[model samples]
Target: MKSKGNLWRVSTTVSQVAQPLPEDKSVDLVVIGGGFTGNSAALEAARRGASVAVLEARTVGHGGSGRNVGLVNAGLWIPPQEVIGIMGNAAGHKLMAALAEGPSRVWRIIEDAGIDCEATRNGTLHLAHSAAGVRNLQERHRQGAAMGWPVECLDAKETARRTGSLAFYGSLFDPRAGTIQPLSYARGLAAAAHEAGARLHDQTKVTRIRQLGDKWIIEANGFTVRARALLLATNAYFDGIEMGFRPEFVAVSYFQFATAPMPARLRESILPGGEGCWDTAVVMSSFRIDEAGRMIVGAVGDLDGPGRPIHAAWARRALSRVYPQLADLPFEHDWCGRIAMTADHIPKIVALGPNAYASFGYSGRGISPGTVFGTQAAIALLEADESVLPVAPVRTHRERLVRAKEVYYESGAVLTHALRPALF
Candidate 1:
């Protein structure tokens, strides 16, 4: 069968309404963008008894939040030490502590909200694609251990047994991480937020945002809103509204394909423990088995762009190289999402004048950081306490040569996908 649309959208059991924005209204806070961050912030704000409104340009989870690989991983892509080196010991440790608990925080929300997003806490495996990759994981394991993180490094034999494939050199298993139906998680958050008194409006595109005296003025879809605090959580899907400050980051695309449910016997051997996995290749690829036994694999490239054929072929080849038994299976669903990659691979919280902030640039790590950042940002804004933010808010952030970097990334993915002749 030809590829369907996004697998999460098709498989998600959770749902939310897309109500229109009410005009000429005012509230304590106005959140732009209705993905994980906005919905999360709105949820926290409303629960704290602050009047809040969320305006989503499109449907909830329409952006990266809906389109991710769903590996609710902890911490950023960079090493723990590197984060410390960049942000200093105190700040780094604070952010790391916050993110390291990200999975639990998410699970708590899921449990309290009773969100049924195929929630699994079985953990995740970071597969080593090569001997060098093994060394890299060893270093990561060491760093994690130094910080008292519960990370374990598995040998090649254990890795093979866990992955049901003899492709990896080794693997790093992080018990703190897991997987979920990402879109469902976002929708469930939105639903819970609405129930908690947050006014959420989808399909409401903001045309302009400006500071009017002490209040923030937002004009969207012929509607106006005045709020004491504002959060632009648009991330990679920013609509470029006439806001004075725009977040800067290179947009990189990641695509995923899912196969029809495998037979019980076959599925039982592959990822039987239900750990989501990703490899260490530069052009990284991720794989996992959903609750229904469907095998989903993802890689860093656009499946909807000119390199579609190249990426598709690479995906098939990569899958065969790892799990040759599943080579004959055809993908039944495919979709792509853009990532807001900062040069430093760190998320940013840009201060947008007084009582206003814009957050973006999670690189590829969204689920946890988005939740932590969103939740904390809400509390900080509502209480006028910036100290609660995980990352220090900056007055301005800029990325140079964003377009060129985007082209460079896409070209690299195309070239890499087009020509990796050896076994991975």
Candidate 2:
């Protein structure tokens, strides 16, 4: 329902126009959902001189796009070999190579469009939580290097120096990765699309879509728009849309808490290299410092759910465990967002019909992949080509144990957080 928590609403301001849909209109393309994917698609299509319109059930960045962890990392959460294993050699390699350029594509767009979203292109650290975790990083580093990725496997001593915390055993640092103010970035894309002659309508919920003789008729709030092609980019916020497209993915929630800006001395000592970080634990946790010096920590669970207290307590303890100097500081803001977790943990581009597609399921890695998929999907539809696309479009995608998996993720996170002391 709600798009953002205190951090987004308080720290960022979106510049997109939310005019209601007109009584009747026609465009070369129509996009559903106004997150990064929809907005990026609209921007790409519009930039190519195609008339485009974007419909949003809620305000811009109202889903994972706005609430994301903002790690603009290359590739998926899994190793390159795992990706190749899942999609098979050809398709998986195509996807992998395509996404390897994700961070560059994202940052270039940000710079080219002048999107002021606090983008820091320093890099990211995939930390190892324990001795076993170090083994995982070694393998990831090896695979990444083999694939020509600029990855570095740091020893624990170097990890401590870079992170300013001794909690991690080692780290896998990818120089291609970076961070951004997610909500601001999404809005920036929307604004760029609008400037490029794309029409974006917010608070205009599309009730139904029916193909009408060479055109797609989209019935929204109080109007109908006819388009030659259609795109459904509503990653995790599809329930609000009435019909036509249903993406099957297990839902997982990720929550983040930001503390008040640290003192200059403390800030300099923490995350000295300014790289965002997440660990190798099964129930992983992330920590990073924003431009304003707030230390934002996040994990995989709904902070507003029944386990809110436990999640909050775990965050506090986790903070102390890593950086005890800031343990006395209080959290200034907290929020949560849902992730569309596919059965295989890969994003899907489902072909709805001729000239139509729905893209979803980025798991927790939404920023880079969402932007890449959105831009590429638009190009593929416009040019009637799939070669440039990451993965071949599927007619349908489903996850069988959706509800069960959702519960399992949250339960695992709660149990892990509740039993944090024993593990740490």
Candidate 3:
């Protein structure tokens, strides 16, 4: 069934006016893409007394930032040891430590800015879908504990009690992570950035960018913006604009369906502690309860494509298997968004030019990483200090066979949803 619309768009309490580009302007920084990254950078740069302007093609949070699962998880999808193996000790540790603070940074911003996004810090659960998944969680818990993180390994009975379902072998709980109304958080960032002296223009798509001496010139909405630094934060929803450099990653689609608010009794029994959750299956799924008591379930695959019916049917069966009490509940909202999945699942910071950077490839861990990267990118760019950056900036990054990889991912998701047992 076609979705009524994005639940976040309809339910988001935070609002910001999308003003057009006022006129040709000069600033210390020009940010393209007003999602979490761009807006966070804008807010940071402006707070540091830099002249900043953000140009967004659509309204703030119109991209994956608005349509995500809203899981404010810490670290990347890969475990910390894998990250250290790939990036080596120093750089890997730097990135992990920075991202480990992701949830707190998000909460701090919400508190300081008085932005109400239904902010919750109760933590998140990483469910084990099978015995192999259990081992994976055990390894994750070991790695996190070695890093001095407060990660706990829960038994099957405790997992069932916490999640209100007996669908898993065990679970890993991270007290640092949480959930939020993602769209509202994006809009709140935009609003806070605007209040902190950053100029933000929505419906302003940048078409061209060029460097003149030490300044970067941006053309958008028939206006010219010359700045000393630039940040391309479009991620998976990058519009077709030639900014001399393109961020590359395999774009994978993820869709979600939300049921209407359940009764208080039902809501109290399911996820009563307000934890967000996702399983360890290869084609994983996430489920969480919103502030209004609505249960949202999401997985890989395009909900608007030919596999829509298959995915929609799978959603019902999957939810029923876990929470049989909600089997007859009808989904009232559905939406889909793309994730910029990197080969190694590590985010990249590309040095576009002198004092300029473009960050992408969060690999489905956008909220915390985006916030950390955006804030660090701004500080590193404005202060001319590469050491301030979480990850060392590279000259260029290229992903081969992006389209084919996208197809492979979507097809795998569709095939799994069609053939996998409901008990899984």
Question: Backbone clashes in each candidate structure, one number apiece?
Answer: 0, 0, 0
Residue-wise C-alpha lDDT for candidate 3, range 1-424, written one tens digit per residue:
5567899999998878568897999999999998999999999999999999999998999999999899999898999999999999999999999999989999999999998898899999999999999999999999999998999999999998998898989999999999999999999999999889999999998999988999999999999999999999999998777667878999999999999898888988899999999999999899999999999999998987999999999999998999999999889999999999999999999998898998999999999999999999999999999898889999999998989999999999999999987533
lDDT of each: 0.91, 0.89, 0.92
- By the lDDT metric, which is better: model 1 or model 3? 3
lDDT of 3: 0.92
In model 3, what lDDT does residue 349 have?
A: 92
Residue lDDT tens for model 2, 1-424 = 2323558667886566767786788999999999989999999999999999999988989889888888898999889999888999989888998889999999999999999898999999999998999999999999999999999999999999998988879999999998999999999999999999999998888998999898999999778999998999998888755555688888899999888899999998899778999989999889898889989999998987899989988998999889999998889889999999887888999998889999999888999999999999999989888776788999989789788888999999999999866122
TM-score of each: 0.98, 0.97, 0.98
TM-score, predicted candidate 2 vs. hidden true structure:
0.97
Residue 192 miss distance in model 1 (angstroms): 0.6
Report the poorest 10 consecutive residues by lDDT, candidate 3. 238-247
Checking candidate 3 for backbone clashes, the offending pairs are none
Model 3 residue 415 distance off true place after TM-score fit, in angstroms: 0.3
Name the regions of candidate 2 deviating beyond 4 angstroms: 1-4, 240-242, 422-424
